[model samples]
Target chain A: MTKKIKETSNSETVVKTEEGKTLDQTVSALSSDAALFNREITQFNVEAETKKQRTATIVKNIFVYTFLTLCAIAAFLPFYWMIISSFKTEAEYRESIPTFFPRTFQWKNYSVVLSQTGAGASFGRILLNTLVVGLLSTTLGLIVIIITAYALARINFKGKNFLFALMLATMMIPGEMYTITNYITVSKWQWNDTFTILIVPFLVSVYYIYLLRNNFMQIPNSLYQAAKVDGLSDMGYLIKVMIPLTAPTLVSISLLKFIGTWNSYIWPRLVNIPDWRMISNWVTSGFTDSAGILGGSTSEALNTLKMAAVCMVSLPLFLLFIFCRKYIMHGVSKSGTKG
Target chain B: MPDKKDTLPQNDVNDVAGVEENVSNDAPQQPQAVKPSLAQKTKQAFADLGKKIKGVFVKDQVALIRDAGNTVITAEMLAGPQLSRKEKFSRFLHSQSGWLFVLPAVLLMCIFTFYPIINAFVGSFKQNYQATTGRFDGFGFENFVRVLKGDTGTGGATFLQCLVNTLVFTLVSVPLSTLIALLISVALNSIKPLQKAYQTVLFLPYLTNSLAMGAVFATFFTIIGTKSNPETPGLVNLALQAFGIAPIDWMGIGSPTWELGAISIPWAKYIVVIVYEVWSGLPFKILILFSALQSVNKQYYDAAKIDGASRSTILWKITAPMISPMISYLLITGIMGGMKQYSAIVGLFGEQMGIDYDMGTMVGYIYRYIEDGYTGYAFAGSLMLFAIIMVITAISNRISKKRVTY
Candidate 1:
C-alpha cells in the first residue's frame, strides 16, 4: 500500500521535471545574438547595483538588529528584575531608590518561602500538588485524545463528521460561560478540594483531539491496508503504525497540556482553596499572608520574599521551556498554520 | 487477476452455506450429534457466532474499500443473500465502533461541559438557587435584572461597569497587541541574525505564571514615596521622572481617573492592564504572523522590487494581504480571550478588585457573586457574558468573511 502511494507521487514529480526541462530549452532556443548582448548589458547593470544594494541591506539589518535587541531587552527585563529582586536583602530592596543589582544576596528568602506554611499547606506541598495534577491530567487526557483522533481519522463509521463538528462548535464558546455551572457540579459531587475536581473537568480537550486527528489523517491509508493484510487488528494498527508515526505530534500535545495544567489558575482557585491550592495560589495568597513574619514588618522585605517565591514557582516551567523549546514552538506554529 | 481474487470470498461463502446445511441434515439422524453435551453445545454456538460476526465484518471491509472509489464490486457480492440476525447485529457493532472510541470523551463532555452549560442557562433565571437543597425558589428575570442593575448588594461597580470595563479592555488591547505583534513579526522576519534568539526571548512571557508575573508588574508600578516625603518612586515613576514628569501613582488611591457621572475610568489601572495584556498576548500573535510572513511568496517581492515599489508599498500590498487571514483569526480569538480576562487582573489587584470591586471585569464580577453564594447572579452574569461573546463572534465572523483574503 505504501509503495503504491509513493510510486504515484514519484511519477508526478518526474512529469513535472520533464515539463520544466522542455520549457527551459524553448527559452534558450528563442534567444538571438542581439537579445544575448542586451541580456549581458542588463546583467552588468545588475552586478553594479548589487554593490549598492549590499550597503543598503547592511544599514537595514543594523536598524533591524538594534530594534529587535531593544524589544528583546524589554521583554526580558522584567524576568531579570524578578530574579535580581529575589536575591536582594530587605533593606536593599526597599532603599528609596531601587538598586538594579543586589548589594548583598539573601539566598535565605528561598529557604524561607519553601519552609513557610500558609493555610496548613506549605509551598513544597503546593508544588507537589501542581506536579501531580499536571502529570495526571495530561496523561489521561492524551489516552482519550489518541483513541478518538484515530477513530475519527482512520475508521469509517457513521456520524463521525457530525460528532467532530459538534466538538468543534464547543470550542467557539468562551470557557467563562461554563465555570459557574462547573463549580456547582463539582460542589454537588463533593469533588471540590480533591484532585479529582482538577483532573476530571478538563480531561477531554477538543483542540488536542483535532490536532491529533489532523496528524493521524496525514498518515497514508495504505499503511492501514497493509497492516490489515498482515493480520493486524484495529488497535494494533493504531498503536504500532499511527501512534509511532505521530510521536512528535503526541509529544507536542502532551507538553502543551502539561504546561496548560501547570499554568491553570481560575478553575483550581475556584474549586480548591487554601488546602488544595496549587503553586500559583500559593504565589498569590501565601506570600501576602507570610509578609509580616517573613518580611519583619518592612514592605521591602515582603516584596523581596514575594519575588523569591515567584522565581521558585516560575523556574521549573522556565527551564522546561528552555530545554524543550523546539517542541513547544513547533506545536504552536503547527496549530497556527493548520488553523 | 484482481477480479478473480474478489470472487474467492463469494465462493467461500457458498461453501460455508453448503456445510451448514449438511450438518443440520445429519444432526437428526445421528443421536450423538443431536444429544451433545452442554459444553460441546456451548462451544458449537460460540463458533457459529464467531463465523457470523466475521462474515459481517468481511462484508463491511469490502464495502469500505469500495467506498474509497478505488475498487469495483462484483454483481454476486452486491446482491448476495439477506443479512441474518447475527450478521445484522455484527454490522451494527461495526458501524458503532467509532462511537465506542469516542464514547469516553463524549460522555465526559456531556456531564461536565454540555450539561453544565445548559444548567447555567436555566439557573440564570432562578432568583435564589440553594446549593445545599439543590433547588431554586422560583424562575424569573430577577437574577438578570439585579445583576444588570448592579444591585448585587455588594456596593461595587454595577454590572454595567464591569461589562464596559471588559468591552474596553477587549477593544483596546486586542487591536493594540495585534498591531505591535505585526510590527515585531515583520521586523523579526526581515532580520537574518539571532532571529531564533529574539523569538525565544519574546515567547518567554507567554510561558510565565501570570500571577507571579503580575506580582513583578505590581512591583514595577509600586511607588516608594508618599506625598509628604516626595522621594524614591518605583521603576515606572523613575522612568517618567527622567523626562521631567511628576511621579504617577499607578495602582493606589491617588491613581489617575476620568469620571463622567456614575461611570469612572481608571486610567492608571487601564494602562497597567493593557500593558500586561499586550505583553502577554504578543508572543502568540507574533508566532502566527511571523510564519505567515515567512510563507509570503518570494516571487511577489521580486516583482514588486522590479517595479521599483517602496518598502512600505511592498509590505502593505504584497505582504499584508498575504497574511490578512491570520490577522483576522488572531483578532477574533484575541478579542474572545480578552473578554474572558480574570486571572491576570486577580494576580495584579487581588480578589476584591479594589475596596469594592472597582477594578472587577465581567468574569471577575461573576466570580465575586459566586464567592458570595449568589449562584443565580453568577449564572446570569455568565449568560450575559456568553451572549456578548456570541454577538462579538458573529460580528467578527461576518467581518472576516468579507475582509479576509483567504
Candidate 2:
C-alpha cells in the first residue's frame, strides 16, 4: 500500500482519453492547475495498481503452469508406462527392480499375441466383429434416431409428447436393469454369436434420438411451410434441408455411438461368444507366449503381451480422436453446457 | 405429386365433362374477369378439387392455386376444416405419418428396453424360475431374501461384500477425482502458454479404454514374483521404496485387509483402484469444469478485483459459485458411472476380480449371478442396483436443486 502511494506520487503523464481530450486541456479550460495535478495523481495510482496486478498475474501464472505440468504428467503416466512395458521383456518386466525404459524393445510381443489367436479367438476375427458391429449399429442407430427425431420434431401426431417422455424416462433408469432382461430376451430368441444380436438390441439410443429431435426442431416451421408451397414433399424437404442442417450433430452422434460399440465389454462378455466378441471383450483375457513361439519354455499370462494388445486396441481410438476431435469435443461440450 | 398435376390436363384431353365441371366451378366466382389460361385453370381446378372453398380468379382477385394436386391444402388449412367422419379419419391417418418415423425406435425400445424392465421386475419375483422353461414354483419375496441373506447357494462374492466394495470404491474415488479435476481445470484455465498441448495431454486419457488403462495401472502396483525368485515389486513399490517405505503386495493374497463380518476393506487395493479411477476419470471432469470456468462471466472477476478481493477470494466467491452447477453435475454423473464400474476392476484384478470375486461391484455381483445361472438372484440384484441408483439420483437432484446458481 505504501509502495502504491509512492508510485502514485511518481507517475504524472496524464494520459489522453479516447475523445482526444487530455487532463491538461480540461484543467486549463477550468483554469485550475491544482485540479490537473490531482487528476494526474489519480492516473498514476491507477497505473500503479495495474502494474502491481501484472506482477501478481505473472506469479499466479507460474503457479498455474507448474500445477498444470504436474497434472499433465500424471494424466500421461499410464500411457507412457503401458508403452514402455509393452516393449520390455517379460523377465525384465517382472524384475525386482523396475526398469523405467526397456533395455531392449520387444516388437515380437505383438507378433506373439497376434499369432496366438487360438486361446482368445484371433485378433483379426475380433477386429472384424468389432468393425462390422460398429458400422452396422452406428448406421442403424442413426437412422432410428433421425427418423424418430424427425417425426417428433416436425410432424403433428397424437401421443407424441407421451412417447417422447417415455423415451427420456428410460435414460433415468440404470442400464443394468435392461441388460439382465435383454440377456433373457436374446437368449429366448437364440440370437447368440450373431452380429444381429449386437446391432439390433442397441439400435435405439433414446438420448441420441432426443438430441437429434432437438436439432430437428431448430429448423424453422416457415421453411417446412415454404417447402409445402414449393411442391416439395415432406420426405424431400427432410432429406435436402433438415439432414444437411443437422449434419454436425449427426456426425458427433455417430462417432460417439461407434466409440461406445468399440468400448462395450459387459454385453459381449455376458453373451460369451468367442467368435463374435467385441474389441473390449478381448482385453481381459490372458495373452500368453503359447507354443513356445517367442522362445519361451513356459506360457504365462504375460504383462508385455497384454500391453501390446492394449496398444493395438488404443491406437485406433487415438486415430479417431485426432481425426474427429472437433466433432467429438463439440458433442461432449454441447451435452455439458446444455444440460 | 407435381408430375401428376403437371401433365393432368394433356393426359385427360378426352375427359371433357371433367374439364367443363372445372370451368363451371370457377365460372360463377369469376363472372366479371376473363378466364385464366387452360393450364392455369386446370391447375387451379386440380388444386381446388378436394378443397371446395372459393374457386380461383374472381375478378382476378382469388390467388391462383398452383400445384396443390387434389389435396386439402391451403394457407389457412391450418385453421382446420369441417369434415365428414371419413375425411377426419383420413386426416387422422395422415397425421399418423409421424409414427412411421418413430416406429423402429419404438419397436426396438419396447423389445429391448421397456419389456426388459418389466420382465426384470416380474422375473425377480418368480421362485426357482427357469429361464428356458419359463417355470416358477411360486412368486413371493424368496429371491430378494436369498440375495440379501447371501444365500444363493453359490460361493462367489456375497452381496454385502460387493455392496461395501462398490460403495467404498465409488464414494472414495468420485470425490477424489472431482477435486483433482477441479484443481487441474483451474490451473489449465489460468495458463496461456502451451495451453493446447497441455490440454491434449490431459485429455489423452478420456478416449482410452478403461480396462486397458486399468491393466497398465495394475502393472504399476503389481508384485510380479514371490520371495523365492523375487521379481519386481512393481513401479509403485519402487517409488515407495525411494521414500523408505517397504514393499507391499497390492493386488496379491498377502495384501492388507480390515475385515468385519464378511466385509473387508483392503486399503492397499482400494488405493490402487482409487488411483486408477482418479487418473481415468480426470479427463472428463476436467473437460466439463474447465469449459464451465471458461464460460463464467468475466465481469464478476473484474468487479471482485476492483473491490480488492484476493485471488483465492475471487476463486471461491465468484468462480466456484459460477461453476457450482457443473461441479454438481460432474459429481452426480461421476458417482453414477463409478457405481456401475465393472470392466476396470476386471482389467486390474483379472476375471475373478481379486481372489474369487472379493472386489466385486454391484454390476459385478449381478453378472456373478447371471453367469452362475442364478437368474432370479441376478434380477433381484439388478433391481436393488436400480433402486440404489434412483435413490442416489434423487438425493443428488435435491442437493443440486438447492445449490445450483444458474
Candidate 3:
C-alpha cells in the first residue's frame, strides 16, 4: 500500500510539472502514451470492482431478499393462518397436533355466513350495509372536506387563521368526547337504526382537510392565477386544475376515509339495531354465526369459522392493497412528503 | 328536558287538517295607518339612550347592550380621520371581510361539530340519568373532586388509575412503535422490486377494523380448558410448552401477581391492548417514514458515497437529519393518537370478552362509568385525560420542534 501510494504521488507530481507545456505537441505525445496506461488502469479497476461487487452484491441481495421475504411472510402469516383455518373441519382444529392445512376445505362456511337463515345477523346483509356506509360516508366526507380544504387553502378570507386553528384544535380533542353528544343528537333526530347515523355524524374529517389543504397549498400560485386570467370560475379552477394536480393526494385521503368508515366499529355498534346491521356486526357484535355452522362453542370449526369471517371482511381490502400496491405506496408517500 | 321537549318538533296533525277556519282571522285586521311619529321616535330613542346608560352601570344589563363599545376596532384610527397611511389601512381591515371565505366552514363546523362539543361541555357539568328526564342536579366541583380522589362511591371503579394508565401507555408505546416503524421503513426503503409488496403486506393489520383485531387477540389470549390436567393451549402457552416451561394461565379469574396458585400475568391487559394497538398502528408510521425517506434527495447519498461514507454513516449523517421534521411530526401525532385510544380496548374487553373490562384505560373507565349511569364522573375523567394529553403533547411539540434539525 505504501509503495503504491508513493508511485501514485510521484506520477501526480510529474503530471503537474508537465501541465505548463500544455500546447498541442505535449498533448499529442502524452495522449498516445497516456491512453494505453489509462486503459490498463481502467480495465484493472473494472475487473477488480466487478469481481468484488458481484460477490458483495450477491451476498447483499441474498440477505436483503431473505430479510424482506421474512418480513412479508410475518406480515401475512396471521392473515394466511386466519384464511386457512377458516376452511378446516372442527375435529381437525381441536387435535393435539392440529393440521396446519385442512385435509378437506369446508366451503360451507362462506355460504353459512352469507345465507340469511332469517334467524340471526346475516353476513351478506352486513356486507351490503358496510358497502353502503363506506361509499356514502366517503363520498359525503370527500365532498365536504375537499371544498372546505380548497377554500381554506386558496381563498384568502377573514377569520381564516382562527378557523384553521379551530380545525387543528378539533383534532386534539378525543373522538369519544363527541360520542355521547353525537349519540344524543342522533337519537333526538330519530336517526338510530338508519344509515345516516353512520354517515352524517362523521361527514368531515379535520385531519384529511388539513392534509389536503397542505397539498393544495403546494400547487404553484401561477397555475391558479393563469386559470383566473382565462376567466375560469373558482369552482372551475378547482375542478379543472386543482383536482387533477392533487389527484394523488385526493386518492390517498379518499382511501383512508373509505377504510376508516369501513372499519368503524363503535358508533355502528351503539346505534345499529338488529335488522339494520352492517358487516362489522357479523364479526364483532354477533359473530354472524347461528345454527351449527361454527360447529358448537368449543369446536375447532368455531375458531375456523371466526377466521373465515375475518377473512371475508378483510379480503377485499387486502386484495385491493395487493393489486394497487404501487398506487397506494406512491399516493401515501406523496401525501406525507408535502406534510 | 323541558327545553328538549320545546325543541322537539310537535306534529299538529288533525287539529288543522281540513279545518276551514278563515286564515285572515289569525292574521288580525291590518292596523290603521299609524306610522311612528317623530315624537314617538324621539321617545323611543330617548328610551334606548336610557337603556344604554343603564347597561353601562347595571349588572344585569347584558341583554340591553349590543357591543358595550368594545367592537373590534383599530385604535390607531381614533385620530379623527387625521391618521397616517398605516392607520387607514388598519381601520379598513377592521371593517372588511371578518368571516369571508372561512364563514362556510366555520358555520358548518359550528352546527355540526361545535354544537355537539358545547353539548358535551355542558353535559360534563350535570349528573343525569334516563335520557329524557329533566331531573339533573348540579354537583359543582364534586365530579372533578371525585375524579382526582379516585372515588366513585356508588358508581364503579376509580378513574384516576385509568388516567395514569393511559398516560403511561401512551408515553411508553408511542415512542416504541414509532422507533420500530422508523427502523422497518428505513430497511424497506433500500429494497427495489419487493418494496411495494412489503409495504402492502405490513399495512394489512392497520386496514382491518380495530374491533376485529381486538376480538381475535382476546380470544387467543383467553385461558383454554379446565383445571385438572389443565391444557393451557393458546399460542403463548404452546410456545412456553415447546420451550419445556410451565404454561401461564392467561386471563384466569385470579390475580396473576405474587400469590401461590395465582395466574401472575403481569400487565396482561396493557400488553394485550398495546399489542393490538401496535399491530394496528405500525402502518401509519411506516407510511409517514417512507414518505419522509422519499423526500430526501439522492444527491446527498451520492455525495456521501463520493466521500467514502458507509451506509450506516450515510443514514446517521444524511438521512436522519433530513427526516427529523417528519419524525417530530410523527412523535406529536403519535402521542396524541395513543392518548385517545379507546376502540381497541372496548372492542376486546367490553361486555363480550367475558373478562372484567379493563377500567385501566382512561377512555375505558370513562366509557364504563357512563354505561353504569355515572355521567358526571365520566366527564370529569374525560376532562382530566384531555388535560393530561394536552400538557404532554404541548411539551412533546415544544421539545421536538426545538430539537428538529430542519
Candidate 4:
C-alpha cells in the first residue's frame, strides 16, 4: 500500500497529464461568452469573478489593516509601558488606578541605578555581563547544535533511529527533572560563581537540534550529491551546502538561545550567590533587593528600579527585532514549523 | 520448498534415531522412518533430553577442550570481517577531518546537558550543607515527604500549594494563549499586505527573555499604585485615583469582599500576571501556529469558496481540522511548560517584594526548599511537580486526540 502511494507521488505523471490539457486556448475562445453566461456556469469566468471579488477583498484589506494596527498596539504596549513607567515619580505613580501615561519624568532613576559604585552590581556591568553570556552561550550552542543536527539529519550509524527518538523523548521530559542535579553538577565543578556556570550548562539543546535537522533534511539531495561529485566530504557538504541553506533557521535558533540566556534569572540566581553576581543580578536581584545586596530586603523603589532594569535588558532584543525583523521572522517561520 | 515441515520430522528425526541399525547393517545410513504415536512422541522427547544431559556429563576432557578451543577460534574467524569493518568505520569516524567536526559538540553537550542532569539528580538525593557536610545519608523519601507536607521548616508553606499554583497557572494560561494565538494567526493569515510585519511584531515577545520582561511588567504595575500613600509608583493606583476610585494594592493579597462597591478580587496583581504571561507567550504560539497554518493548502479554501461557503464556515470546516494536529502538539507542550513556569514569577516576586516569600506557584515552593537546604523536601516537591505536569500533559494529549481530526 505504501509502495503504491510512493510511486504515484514520486512519478510526475499525474501532474504532467493534467498540465498537457492546453486549456488556455479553449478559455480564450470562451472569453467573449463569459459576460453573456456570467450569471450561468462557464469555464472562462474566473478572472471576471475575481474582479467582482474586489469588494470583499477591499473590506478584508481594511479589516486586516485595522486588526494589525490593534495587534501592533497590543504587542508594543507592554514595552512602551515599561519604558514610560520607568520615568514616573513615586507620587504620580501612586494613583488608585494605574495611569496609561506618566505625569512626571523621573530620569534620576536611571542614574541612580547606574551610578552606584562599589555596589553589588551596576546597570552597566550587568548589561556587559548579559551581553557576554548571551554571545558566548549562543555561539557555543550554535556550533554544537549545528554539527550534531547535521550528523543526525544526514548520517547513518548504529542506533541512529533510537538516538533520534531519544532526543524527542528528552523533549517530553520537563527541564525541572534535572534542575537540582544540574545545580549540584555546577557546584561540584567550582563553576558556581563564574560565567562558565551561568552559560555553560545549556550548551546543546535537543529542540534546537531537532529544529535544525528538520530544516536541513528539507534541503535538496541534489545539492549534496553534486557536492559529493566535486570531492566534498560529508562535513564539507554540511559546511558548504546545508549551513547556507539552513542559515535562517540557525539565526532564529541562535537569537532565541541568546534571548533565553540573556533573560535567564533563575539559573543565575540558583547557581550564584550575592557575593558573586551577573548582569541579571543588577536588574532582577538588585532591583528587587531593597539594599541592593544579594539577599537583602525588598526595596520601596522596587517598581521603578525593576522597570528600569527590564527596559535595559529588553532594549537590545527590541532594537534587534526592529532592525532585523525580516531575518528574525524568516528564522521563526523556518524553525517554528511544528505548532 | 519441498514441504519440509511435513517430511522433515517424519523422515530425518526417525532416521537419525535409527542410524545405529543402519550402521550395523553396513547400509551407510541410506534412510529410515519411524512414525510415533502421540504417547510415543512424548516419551521420545523425554528420552532425547536425558540423552543430551548424559552426553554432556560423559564427555571426555581432552575432546571437550579441543571442541571448546575450536569453537572460540572459529567464532573469532567468523567475526574477523565484521571487526575489520567496524575498525575501518571507526577510523574514518575518528579521522582528523571528521573528528574535529564532531568533537566540539560532543564535548559541549556532555559538559552542559548530561553533566548538569546527573549533578542535579545527585544533589537532590544528597544532604549537602553550604559547600560543606557533603554527605549522602540514603535517607530515602525523607526529603520527598518533607516537601510534600510543607513541614521542612522553611516558613511552613507546603509544596502542595506550589503544585496547585503551577496547575492553575498552566490551566489558565495554556488554553488562553493557544486561543489568542489561533485568533491572531487566523486574522494574520487572511491578510495580504503587512502580514509579515504584523507577525514579526506579535512574535517579537516570544524571542525576548521572559525573566527580564517579567521584572519590567512588575515595575510597570507597581508604579501604577495609588498616589495618596504611595511609596511605590504603580499603574493600577494611578488609573484608579484618576477615575476617583480607590487604587488597588496590587502586589499584596487582598481581603475577599461580598458586598457591593467593595474589593472583590485581587484584580490588579492577577491582571498583571495574566497579561504578562499572555504577552510573553503569544509570540511563540503565533510563530508555531502561523507556520502550521501556512502549511495548509489554499486549495481547501478554494474548494470551500466554490461551494459558496462563508469565511467562518470555511475556517470551521477546513482550517480547524487541518491545524488540529499542530494544536494538539502546542496544547501538550504548552500545558507542560505552563505547569513548570517559574522564571517570570521569580523575576516578579523577587526575594522580598510580592506577597512575602511563600506565595509563588509550586516551583517557587520547591525553590524555597532548595534555598532552605531541604534537599529531601525539594526533591519531593520536584517529583510531585513533575508527576503533576506529566499527568496534565497526558490527559491533555488524550483529550486532544479525541478532538483532533487528523
**Winner by DockQ:** 2
State the lDDT of candidate 1 residue by residue for B99-178, as single tens digits.
88998999999987888888888888877887656788888999999887777786888889888888888899999999
- Greater lDDT among 1 and 3 belongs to 1
Could you report the DockQ of all the candidates, in the order they appear? 0.41, 0.52, 0.22, 0.26
List the TM-score for candidate 4's chain B.
0.65
Tally clashes: model 2: 4
Ranking by lDDT: 2, 1, 3, 4
* The candidate that achieves the highest TM-score relative to the unseen native structure: 2
Q: Give interface RMSD for all predictions.
A: 2.7, 2.3, 4.1, 4.4
C-alpha RMSD of each candidate structure in angstroms:
12.6, 8.4, 16.7, 14.0
List the candidates ranked by DockQ, beginning with the highest: 2, 1, 4, 3
Model 2 misplaced stretches (Cα beyond 4 Å): A1-59, A334-339, B1-84, B227-229
Model with the higher TM-score, candidate 2 or 3:
2
TM-scores of all predicted structures: 0.82, 0.83, 0.71, 0.69
Give lDDT tens digits, candidate 4, residues A1-339.
Answer: 987545444333333354453334434344424423442554468788788799788887787688778877888877887787678754454444556678777686666556653336655666677778788989988888888888777776555676668567766655665666667666777765577777666887888888888898998888888999999988788888889888878777887777676656667778765444565556655544344442224455445655666677678777877776666666554443211
Error of 3 at B406 (Å): 4.6
Which parts of model 4 have CA positions greater than 4 angstroms off? A1-71, A89-91, A94-107, A117-119, A153-164, A215-242, A273-276, A286-299, A326-339, B1-132, B189-201, B219-248, B255-271, B290-318
TM-scores for chain B, listed for all candidates: 0.80, 0.79, 0.66, 0.65
* A1-339: candidate 1 lDDT, tens digit per residue: 998555544444444464454333334334333344554565588866888899988888888888888878888988999999999877677777788888887787787777777546887788888889899998999999999998889887888999999899888666777877888787878875568888988999898899899999999888889999999999999998999999988888888888887778888778865666777777886454244544465333377778999898789888988888778877866554111
* Residue ranges of candidate 3 with Cα displaced over 4 Å: A1-67, A116-120, A153-161, A214-245, A286-290, A293-301, A323-339, B1-108, B127-131, B153-157, B189-200, B219-223, B227-232, B252-265, B294-322, B350-354
- CAPRI rating of model 2: medium
Q: Model 3: per-residue lDDT, tens digit, B1-406?
A: 3332222212232212211122223334546485433223322332433322112111221112223364422111211245679999887775444344345556657766788677667767775434435357753777777677766675333564566557666777778878878778888888788787787777776456665566666655655565335443566566667889765655555425342231222365566666666666677788888878988899999999889897779878888889988888877877776776766665566543325443346777766665665766666777777778788878987898688898
Clashing pairs in 3: A90-A301, A126-A279, B256-B263, B256-B264
